[model samples]
Target: MLFSLVKKDLLLAKKYLMFMTIFSFVSPLLIASRSSFSDTGFVSLLITVLLTEYILYISISSLEDKSKGAALLCTTPYKRNGVIKAKYLLILIIFMCCFILYTILTYLGISPNIQQMSITKIGTIMLVLSIFFGILIPVQVKFGYEKTKYIGFIIVFLTPFVLPNLIKWYTSSNLSINFTISLSQNIYGWIPFVLSLIIGYISMQVSIRIYSKKDL
Candidate 1:
C-alpha cells in the first residue's frame, strides 16, 4: 500500500521528473555559452539548479491538488499519513537525483565548479525547499491549491531578498553571535538543515490532520 502510494505520486509527477532531468544537463551549458568557465557560469548553474528543483517539487504536489487528485486520494483506502509521507519521500528522491546530476556534470567538465555541492550548499538548497514545501503542502491540503499561489508569491518575491541577507548576517557576525555559535557547535553546522527538517515534519503532520478532517 505504501509503495502504491509512492508510485501514484511518481506517476503523477513523471512530467516534472523528465523536464528537470533534461534541464539539469542543458542548463549549465546554456549558462556557460555566455561566460565560458567563469564564476558567473557557476553562479548561473547553481541558480538554475535551485530554481528547477524548486519548480519540480512545487509542480508535482501543486498540480495534484489543482487536478483534484488530492480529493480523490482522500476517498481511497490509503491513509492520509501515507499520502503526506509519500509526497515528501517523492520530493527527496527527485531532489537527490537532481543534485547528484548537477554534481556529476560539474565534475565531468560540462558544468562549472560546483565544489562538490558541499554539505552546506546542499543543506541551503534543501532548506529552501523545506520551507517551500513546508508551507505549500499544508495550504493545499487544507484550502486546496488555489490558495497556494498567495504563499507561492511570498516565496518567489520575499525569500530571494530575505535569505541572502540572513545568510550574510549569520556568516559575518562576531562575539555578538555567541548564541548562534553555540547552535553551530551543538548541531554540527546543520542548524538550518535541522530546522528545515523539523518544519517539514511539522508541516506534514499539519497537512495530514487537515486532510483527515477535510470534506472530500
Candidate 2:
C-alpha cells in the first residue's frame, strides 16, 4: 500500500522527475563552468544532489496541494499516516536515485571530479538533507506546500549571505569547536550518517503527527 502511494506520487510528478533528471545531468557542467575554484567538483556534486531532491520533493508536494489530493487520499485506505509514510519513503527513494545518478556521472567522467564524492561527502550531503527535510516536511504538512514555499525561497536566497557569518560564529565559539573539528575528520562520517537517518525518522514522525491532526 505504501509502495502504491509512492508510485502514484511518482507517476503524477513524472514531468518534474524528467526535469530533475535533466538538471542532474547538466548541473555539474554548469557549476564547473561557473566556478574556477579547486572545489568546483564538490560544489557541483552538492548542488546537483540537493537541487534534484528539492525539485522532486517540492513538485510532489505542490502537485498534491494544488489538486487538493491530500484530502482525497485521506479518504482512501491510505489515510493520513500512510500518506505521511509514503512521503518519507518517496524522499528516501529520491535520495537513492540521486546517489545512483551521481555514481553514474562519476563513472562516465561527466562529473567534474571522479574522486570528489566520498563517504564523508555523502555523510555531509545526507546531514544537510536530513535537516532540510526534517524542518520542511512537518511545516509543509501543517501549512501545505503553497504557503511554505515562500519561506523556502527566502531561505534559498539568504543562505549564502547567512552561512558565512554562521560559520565564523561557530569557529569563534569554543562551545562546539571540538564537535565541529570532529566532523571535519573523515572517519566521523558514520556518526553524522547515523544521526541523519535518525533525524529523518523523527521528521517523518513529526510530519505524520502534523498531517494526522490537519483538517485537510
Candidate 3:
C-alpha cells in the first residue's frame, strides 16, 4: 500500500524530477564557466543550488497530492502513518541520488575537494537540510501550494539576513558565556544538525496527525 502511494507520487512528479536533475547538472557547468569560479566556490554553489532544488522538489511533491484532492489513498487499507513513512522514504531516496550525483561531480573535478569539509560537518549540513526539507514537506501538505509558497519564500529569503544578525548580536554581548558550546562543533562549525533533524521529525509526526484528520 505504501509502495503504491510512493509510486503514485513519483508518477505525478516525474516531470519536475527530471527538470531538477537536468538543472543540477547544468547549474554546475554555468557556475564553473563564471569568472569567479574556484574549486571552493564551485562546490559551495553546487551545494546551495542542490539544497534549494531538493527543498522545492519535496514541497512540490507533497503539494501535488493535496492539489489533486487524492483522498482515495487515505481511505485505502493503508494507515496514515504508512503514507507519511512513504513520503519520508521518498525523501531518503532523493537524498541518496543527490549525494551520489554530487560525489560524481567532485570526482570529475566539477566541484571542490570532498575532503575539505570533515564528515561530521558534512553530515550536519545534510541533517539540517533534511530536517528543513521535512518540515517544508508537511507544511506544503497542510497548506497546499499557494500558501506554502509564500511561507517558503519568506523562510528562504529572510533566514539568511536574520540569522547572521542574530548570531552577531549573541556573540557580541556574551563572549564569556561560551556560545560555541551551544553551537555544533562538527562540520560547518556550528549548531549540531541533529537538533534540527529531531525537531523536524517531531513536526512531521504532528503534521501526519493533523493531515489524517483533514477532510481531504
Candidate 4:
C-alpha cells in the first residue's frame, strides 16, 4: 500500500522530476562559471542539490493539496500512517536520486574542481534535508500546504542567501563564546549523519501521529 502511494506520487510529479533534473545540471554549470560563487565546486554542488530537493519537496505537497488527494486517500483502504510513510519514503527516494545524479555529474567534471562527492558532503546534505522536512512535514500535516508554503519558502529559498552573512556576523561579533570545531575531527565529522538519522526517525513518528489523528 505504501509502495503504491509512493508510485502514485512519482507519477504525479514526473514533470517536476524532469524539470529538476534540467535545473540541477544547468544551475551547477552557471554557478561554476560565475565569479561570485564560483569560488569552489563544492558550493555550486551544494546549491544545486539543496535547491532541487526543496523544489521537488514542495511540488509534491502542492500537488497533494491542489488535488485534495490526501483527504481522498483517507476514504480508501490506505491508512493515514501509510500515507505519511509514503511521503517520507518518496522524499528519501528523491534525495537519493538527486545525490546519485549529482555525484555522477561531479565525477564527469560537470562541476569544476570537484573530483568526487565525499561522505561528509553526503552527510551534510542529509542533515539539512532531515531538519528541513522534520519541522515542515508535521506543520504541513497539521495545517495543510496553503498555510505552510511561506514558511517553506523562507527556510529553503530565502535562508540560503542570508545564511552566510548571518554566520559571518555571528562569528565576528564579540559574543561571550566563540570557538571553532573542525569537521575534520572524526567525531565531529560523523555527527551530521547521526543527527540526520535520529531527526528523520523522530520526524517520521511525529508526522505519522499527526496524520493518523488528522480529521481528513
lDDT of 3 by residue, 1-216 (tens): 767777766777776777777765555455445423234333443354445555545554566656663566666777777777777766656655665665666667754433234555455556656666667767766776666666656665565445445545655687564344443444344344566557667867877886787677
Per-residue lDDT over 43-78 for candidate 4, one digit per residue giving the tens place of the 0 to 100 score? 556667667877877887898888999889978998
Number of clashing pairs per prediction, in order: 0, 0, 3, 0
Task: Tell how far residue 142 is off in model 2, in angstroms.
Answer: 1.2
Residue 154 accuracy (lDDT) in model 1: 60
Model 1 misses residue 107 by how many Å? Answer: 1.9
C-alpha root-mean-square deviation, each candidate:
4.5, 3.8, 5.4, 3.5
User: In terms of lDDT, which candidate is strongest?
Assistant: 4
| Cα error of candidate 4 at position 28, Å | 2.2
Which wins on lDDT, candidate 2 or candidate 4? Answer: 4
Clashing pairs in 2: none
Q: Give the per-residue lDDT digits (tens) of candidate 2, residues 1-216.
A: 999999998998888777788778777777667654455555666666766777777777788877889888877877788888888888778878877776777778865454346677687778887898789889888877878997766765455445445645655685553445534555676776888899999999988887777887
| Model 1: residue 93 alpha-carbon error in angstroms | 1.6
Off by over 4 Å in 3: 1-3, 29-69, 111-116, 154-193
